[model samples]
Target chain A: MRPILLSGHTRALTQVKYSKDGDIIFSVSKDQIICAWYAANGERLGTYHGHQGALWTVDVDPTTTLLASGAADNTIRLWDVKTGKLLKTWDFGTAIKRVEFSPDGTQLLGVTERRQGHLSTIVVYDIVLDVEAEQADEHSLRIVCEDSKATVAGFSYGSKYIISGHEDGSVTQWDAKTGELLDSAQIQEDDMQITDLQWSSDRTYFITASKDKTAKLVAANDLRVLKTYVADTPLNSAAITPVKDYVILGGGQAAMDVTTTSARQGKFEARFYHKIFEEEIGRVRGHFGPLNYVAVDPQGKSYASGGEDGYVRLHHFDRGYFDFLYEVEREAEQANL
Target chain B: MSKVAGRTDWAEEEDEDSLALPPPQITKNKDGTETIVSYRIDENGKKVKTTRRIRKTVMKQVVNPRVAERKHWSKFGEEKGKPVGPQSDTTSIAENIVFRPSSNWKTNQSEEKNPIDKQKATLKDAKIKCRICSGEHWTSKCPFKDTMAPEGENAGAGAGTGAEEESAAPGLGPSNSSYVPPHLRGKSGVTGERMGGGKFGQERDDLATLRVTNVSEFAEEQDLRDMFTRFGHVTRVFLAKDRETGRAKGFAFVSYADRTDAARACEKMDGYGFHHLILRVEFAKKPTT
Candidate 1:
């Protein structure tokens, strides 16, 4: 497979996302610039440049009209994806760590960093979902994490529940409308923080990547861990593929200790694991530094990865990726036929 | 250096200016390729003519209407007012990687000697261009080696066995490591033997081996080993064969554990008749510079 390298970021990339149609890729970096690219050819669509501090997270709405990003500047900002205009900006007391839009694109959520006497919280706002409309200033619901800070949060299917992965290695399910905690499941060891949480195509189940060097798949409604994928290094991001029963994970040695270890020893690669078997299938190695995030296309034809080395690699899968099958999987297909 | 197309020496400046130049032209060939001929005057006031053949084909694909419209969206923010298409400063294609995920991908990476075999396969298909038409190749393969004087400074470079004396000349001593045309490296065949073929004594085996020629095409390594083992201990027997057909190419090499045994076999096999032809046997000579 030939990879297309996107080289617009001057600093390490923090996250990348594909549009609902899987055509455009939006990436944010610590360099304070957000870039949009055509996923098929690596062509730069445009750049969004208003954040004053390093960007921590970015998310595109399901309609592909509005883009949301959280930054260390103590605010979450929304931008018009087509014209690159800043539509709305929500101020917070603490820097926002992660931002995501609900499945129906009617609500947006932002996770705040815990610092300076402020307990971390997840806040939700009613989105107007139009480029020309005015967004409300007040948050519709705010869930305070009184025990341990939440690092990553997202909405469940039909907006029935809100699932958040926390700094204390627990996944918590909360009532989306009332902001009440329903259930909690400890997903990782040693109080390691969850770095990323991404939803599957249906949003009923999700994958969480943690600093404990493992990624886990959990049911959203009950907060029950289903499958666990153990990797060699601390994982920064995890993504579930749509059409294929596979998951892609990205991570390596932390950026601070990267100078002490070589790339080979750093384990700077995206590991692919079988969703049911929980066995590693293969790894794609390219980044000289740690891989920060990986996002699979909605159509499951390709994937994109952002790295600490300031590059986004877009890889289109070859025929072999779709052809590989385990003995049992092949027999199952034959039985179906 | 001497390969520059328009570098005329200062002494030939008058003669170069006395010639008239022709206009550039482009012609379309019947095979759907275009032939472009262009001329330009260089900094040295000499003219150069260049020829290029190029083929162009257009591909079409049906895409989603929204994606098709988004491709024409105007550049904004930092890319404001920039022209269409991917700017060179940002996007690029990286090297191709062979990614075939099998059930045993994790175990398959451990025992790979396949890359070296792939390189050897590529070497077999490498084109041999002549450099008198190409000196990057062997002089014997160049049709113009005996007829043409090499271009520019290399004109005085010898064309035959005199390549040895030319390489040892005093002028080339300092920058000899830079590049030397292949024809100037002599026909000693030393450079060719530097790589492998090590199963038999590519290194020191020549000290106790014999080269047998005029052997029948039907000759096998076992037959040669049987014939030569009568003298003493035969270490190895190698019969050069055609790759497609398993027949020998009329030659073989027999190695002995002792040099005296090799000498006795060479004497007995020299005038021996085998399969309607007399054999010529001699001590295998080692390559030397």
Candidate 2:
């Protein structure tokens, strides 16, 4: 399969995501710009250019009209996706590490970085869907990360609970409405930090990629680990494909960290692992440097990856991807017939 | 056409609006295809014509209204006022990759590497090839082995380097293979020497060979042999010919079974007129190399 390469970012890419319909792709980089591209081709839709500092995270509301981004400037800005107009900006004490829109378009959650005597916190805001309406200046609820700073946080299905992966290898769940701690579990290694957390299609379970070179599927309600997929290199991001029972993991060592490692050891690839079996099936290799993020299309048509080389590659699945079947799976299909 | 109301630069005065080439022609074919022919002036001031035939098919895909509306939205930010389509500077297509997945994909990858291991899996289906006749049999069992000299010496290789080694005296053919004739097989140094050390051995003595010159270009090896056979039992007759013209090169070698007989023929052949030219005959000297 041929991959369409989008080279709009001037610096390493931090995140790339597909719209709900899988027609648009939004990417944010450390170069302080957010780019939107049409998924059918590599045509660029537009760019949002109001971030003062390097951007770290970006998220789109369910309706795809409102776009939110958090940056190292310690501010989260909202923008109109169609016109790239700046709508609102919320200031914080520290830089926001992660930002995610709740399942419903009414709320937004952000994880603030712990720095300069400011405690890491998870804050939620009531978002107004109308572009002309004024947004609330104050946060509706805030939860202090007392033990470990949360690196990633997302609202559960129906906005019931908020799940956060911490820097200390623990995943904690908090009440979405009351902002109270509920359940916490050490899902990863003792001190290995979790780098990324992503939810399944239904949002009942989520996968967390950690510095321990493994990603775990954890339930959203009780925070119990279900399946663990181990990899050779430290993973930076992980995404579960919707149609196929496969999980794509993106990771590698930064070339500067270990100068003596071989190119293969610095695994610059997106590995596909069978979700239930935890066996690595295949890998797609193209990035010059380590992959920073991987996002699959919600409609199961394609997947896109952002790399430290400052390029986003969109790959559409070939017929072989859908035709592949395990022996046992083939037998079960025949029995059904 | 450009929107330049007036030209400010004198050297570029509205030449871009002028067209010296012919207009493109389009034709509809009976097979539901369109043929388009276009002409242009190339960089070398040469007129070039291009023709293309294409079939058009309509594909319908129903998408959500929100997505349909978003597709027509105007471009903004850095791409403002730009035409619709992928920009060349920011977008490109990468090379194709084969990513077929299988349960035993790991084993499939490692098997392609070490060829010796793959040889075992294919050994039962392997086919035999005869080096001499290229038939399906072993080289030693080929019917053309004795008649063809194993098909290697017939290539006109000039002078083989292995001949300089003289590893086993001189033989009828180059020792490219280790196959010894049925006579020489299982024989040690004593029995081999009695047979004159090689296939040609004592019968191929260089002393009994005579080099004949001033021969006619139309002369054949058999003609030279007939003329010299009256004086001695002719062992072998070799004629040098032109590779391109395939004509005799005015020289031939005639070997006799006995040196005394070769001397008689050399004396008789010298100064003998043939083809209106006098012939010269002398003992053939072995190459020092």
Candidate 3:
């Protein structure tokens, strides 16, 4: 077997995404650098260094020819994926958390947390038209994203909606097209803080991972809780696989400490390695450590994940199981024919 | 020679106001040459037309000596490595598209309505009706130029043109479902090690294991396994298949506890049959990922 070690980024890689064509993998580091590498050979293609702040997230267009990145300095930079040329940068004037390209690639949505006010804003830019219309005074539409007391952690599929989770233990979904409130749910019982939220592929369901040590799947149409799985540990991040099979939750030591104080006191180990969920037929295991970001391949055969450990692992789903605790006894003599 | 039409949702999406429709009927000369004849009809149905005749000529064919040399170089009188003549017989359709047709219609048309005649006929000499709205004014100053032709007129006028529609070709072959050329197909044999299934503890009752004497005997054993595994997923490259159940006979059963192990084994042992026997590989079951 050929083992490839992908170790180049100086610091923790916060985000990594396979190019739309699946030929290359783009990784962003907290070191403020974006690197592209061959997905098969792990050969480094090139590194883009322009962001002044930590590169928090990166996304590529469906054609894999364009790239967008969001930084903690509240700026979103666009780049040509093939040439690594900086096309333009949009400033949000606050700490930007997440940025995403629309499914059609014509629009860019940049979400930022407000430094002064309680509200966050989703800045929408018509990249194709505005880039050519670069004038002294051209006004672009900036919609007020679901304002939360905490950070706005997630956006929805196709760039059609935004779902914001807050420190106040509530989640709000907004209509991305018209900036209207679609639905809101009180995730925590007035005291629980939500950490992250994700939408299922069909856009009909969504799940939230919170400080309450539970991940809950709720109906998007009515905002009703469909089912809940209590990790009984502090959940750092949660992601539902695009195929709608399983919900993966990342548990950390802090979550373990909180769960240990409850009546069912169990020292929750950070289930860092991958695990298969029987309830979700194809629910594959995630990486080891509190996963910072998890993204599945478009083909759904494998997934790339990054964690707090500053490492990324590619998981290939197979039918057989591996017993981590079991050791195989080897008999060496007569079998060597 | 004729304008073809087609209908699709994207075609309808184009701005209709800017597009101009072609004339009803064009003319072809005695020598199989065709020409475009655009006309304007007055309110009384009298027509004033402008025509541009196109010229046609057949290109001469040539015989290529390089292809002939490749075919007959072994012959006694064949000239080897010599350049072929200009009149090479073999030519492809792609070479013909580059030839530009010369414009000689201006001088050849004596009584015919050529470009000069068409240009000379100004707005004052003839009361030309609008081609689209068929009003009293000529098309150059028609106000309805900004609007599409009436829907009923459009639907009825171009029904026959749909089948023969021609587009600027995106080059040869359909964009979808094209097969690779046969010559490019690999002739190389399966290389590397042979894929084998996992090992099972229990041996098969039907398989008869014989002592290997020479390389020829090993090759024959390998052939036997290849023939047997053809029936199902070959689990092991090491084991031969059972002739009766068409299954991996337990004697040669190489068990990969999982599909990943089996796939890895297959990749490693792809070409190498057994050392003496030619080996065939099969998956015990379908792969999971």
Native contacts, share recovered per candidate: 0.77, 0.79, 0.00
Q: Go through the candidates in order and give each one's C-alpha lDDT.
A: 0.84, 0.83, 0.50
Q: Mind giving the per-residue lDDT tens digits that candidate 1 earns over A1-337?
A: 9999999999999999999989999999999999999888888989998899999999999989999999999989999999899999999999898999999999999999999789999999999989999999999999999999999999999999999999999989999999999999888885998999999999999999999999999998888889999998999999999888999999999999999998888999999999998988888988888899999999898999999999999999989888988999999999999
The list of candidate 1 runs beyond 4 A from truth reads B1-58, B109-289
What is the number of backbone collisions in each predicted candidate, taken in the order shown?
4, 0, 36
For model 2, the stretches where C-alpha displacement exceeds 4 angstroms are A258-262, B1-23, B40-47, B110-289
* Cα lDDT tens digits for candidate 1, B199-275: 22233245457889999998777888888999987755767776568788998877666667777888888978887
Alpha carbon lDDT at A29, candidate 1 = 95
lDDT of 3: 0.50
Docking class of 2: medium
- 10 residues in a row with least lDDT, candidate 3 chain A: A321-330
**Chain A: TM-score in each model:** 0.99, 0.98, 0.75
Candidate maximizing TM-score: 2
* lDDT tens digits by residue: candidate 2, A1-337: 9999999999989999888889999999999999999998889999999998888899999889899999999999999999999999999989998999998889999999999799899999999988888999999999999999999999999999999999999999999999889999999998899999999999999999999999999999999899999988889999999999989999999646645666666888898888888878888989888888999999888999999889999999999988878888899999999
Residue A322 miss distance in model 3 (angstroms): 14
* Residue-wise C-alpha lDDT for candidate 2, range B1-289, written one tens digit per residue: 1345344443355354234666899999999999999888778867788999999899888999988999999999998998999999888999997787778766675667667777886995676766543445687985445433343332112133222223223442244234667677435332233244333212233456788999999888888888999996775676766655889999877766666788899899998887867889987754223
Model 1 local distance difference test score:
0.84
